[model samples]
Target: MTMPQTITVLALDVDGVLTDGKLYIADNGNVMKTFHAHDGLGISLWQKCGFHIVLISGRNENSVTVRANELGIEHVFQNSKNKIADLQSCIQAIGCTTEQVCFVGDDLGDLSIMNHVGYSIAVQNAATEVKTASDWVTSLPGGEGAVREAIEYLMKANGTWDSSVASMMQEHANQ
Candidate 1:
């Protein structure tokens, strides 16, 4: 297996990646998405380590914006019909090349971006085609600690896992 390059920017899809691919519709006509708290904390940890995080989704959910804001993620593009274009724009805005970016996705919508990035990851519940295209596949299903798994895996590969963990632990201890 080929080893991954150092990744500086982490991009993600929302529905099927951060979610379980199940859209929860409430009786009151409101949409409720269940996000794993572990993933949220992982994103926070990633940011603390100075890696950029971007959320690209084919959805226009308010929850996506809310969640991103909560995580201090500034780059979120929802209702993105063309993920490749959006990803390119994000890369340019961040002044990073495709080789410095890692993308985590689940479905066909995520395929092109995954192919263009330096490292591609698929959640365990991702579609077969998506998984086949990924350089690495997480053991956890999407919206269920999958993002956390991806974060840990990438940090370890980048040789920052221990330091990041220590930083988080120190912060927790101080709290």
Candidate 2:
């Protein structure tokens, strides 16, 4: 539980972990992706709490870049076949270490980073092997608020959940 406070960055895999593991390919070679609003909000909250976010994916998709940019996530490494190496580059750029990172994914491709991170998380839809290697598993499946669930769980562990909620509620009340 205390480990959450030590987490300074979150490295996320895009396809399975963020988009239901499906690729929508149009007949004309167009690609599209759907992302959960809840997950976006969760990322915003995490950033507001002063944490960094990094996006890592094997496919080179414009949609992923757009989404990452929209969320203000600057550490985007798309088409990264070597997630662990890419993550290491990100960590170095951010001046953090493996011990300050939380890696979330749903496939075997993520196993390396999952094993190296301080806290590893897997979506409900993650493969059995991925889940087995994770420190925590989300109740919701990926692309369906699973990222949000993971963020909430971490916030709770870091002793910031109540305060974050109170702050949001107070903001709403003031409005």
Candidate 3:
């Protein structure tokens, strides 16, 4: 099987990737999203592996900040109209090249930037054209561990999967 390019940084779009593309808006303006635990663990593993992770989204959701904070993701750009700009900014901030970046997204809004990234992945549930544009299409649907699957592929492709996961497991087991 062919391997994905080296992924030093991963940039993702939040809504469809992390939350099944559904918004839970309460009468009082509260937002709720169901995130898979495995996905969270995968992100933690990616961080442990020393890969930079960022959330670059077009829309702003209340729960995103909470979730990102929970995952210790420091590079988050919400309400970005031009994703490429945010992506460029993120690349600069992280001191990486476009070839070191992997972009995972699920909609039309993500097309331009995804096209430019080194590796572009689409969730199984993404729009047809978006899927067509991706270099890889994940087996998991949006919000159903797609991000984790991508992370695992990337981590393994970059040769950091095993040790990172072991370290994360050990750390958790110690608590």
Best by lDDT: 1
Choose 2 or 3, whichever is better by TM-score.
2
Worst 10 residues of 3 by lDDT: 1-10
Sort the candidates on TM-score, descending order: 1, 2, 3
Separately for all candidates shown, the number of backbone clashes (residues 3 or more apart, or on different chains) is 0, 0, 0
lDDT of 2: 0.88
Q: Regarding TM-score, does 1 or 3 come out ahead? A: 1
Tens-digit lDDT track of model 1 for 1-175: 3355488899999998898878888898778888899999999888988899999988788988889988999999998888888988988988988888889999988888888888899999899999999999999999999999999998888788899889889988999
Q: Poorest 10 consecutive residues of model 2 by lDDT?
A: 1-10
Whole-model Cα lDDT of every candidate shown, in order: 0.89, 0.88, 0.86
lDDT of 3 at 38: 79
lDDT of 3 at 47: 86
| Alpha carbon lDDT at 20, candidate 1 | 86
Model 3 lDDT per residue over 1-175, tens place: 1237477888998889977988888999877778877788888888876788989877787678888899999999999988888889888978998888888999998899888888899999999999999989999998999999999888778788888877778988999
- Between prediction 2 and prediction 3, which has the larger lDDT? 2
Q: What's the TM-score of each model vs. the native?
A: 0.94, 0.94, 0.92
Model 1 C-alpha RMSD vs. true structure (Å) is: 1.5
